[model samples]
Target: MRNDVRALRLSGGLSQAELAGAMGVSRQTVNAIETGRYSPSLTLAVRLARYFERTVEEVFHVDCD
Candidate 1:
């Protein structure tokens, strides 16, 4: 999966730690997500998209390989 998390965070004037605080996760977790090393759960994904005022599909992209 690929996501716009980093761009969104930056455009929203948020640091990884700040985004994590809002998302109720750790900065490391936010880093993991941004780096594509980890994928968030559906619930968390929804929350993230909602926080950014975006749809899940807008924030997350399912890569076909």
Candidate 2:
């Protein structure tokens, strides 16, 4: 999976730490998500969508191989 999290956060004027705090996660977790080093769980994904006020599809995308 690939996500537009960094772009979204930047556009929203949120730093990584701010986004992490809003999502109730660690900054490293957000970094991991942004870097594609980790894939968020469904719950986290939902939380992220809720925080950004966006649909999951708007925040994340399935990258076909």
Pairs in clash, predicted candidate 1: none
- Stretches off by above 4 angstroms in model 2 are none
The 10-residue segment of model 1 with minimum total lDDT is 56-65
TM-score of each: 0.96, 0.90
Expressed as tens digits, the lDDT of each residue in 1-65 for candidate 2 is: 89989998999999999999988899999999999999999999988988889999899998786
TM-score of 2: 0.90
List lDDT for all candidates, in order: 0.97, 0.92
Task: Show the colliding residue pairs in model 2.
Answer: none
Q: Which has the greatest TM-score? A: 1
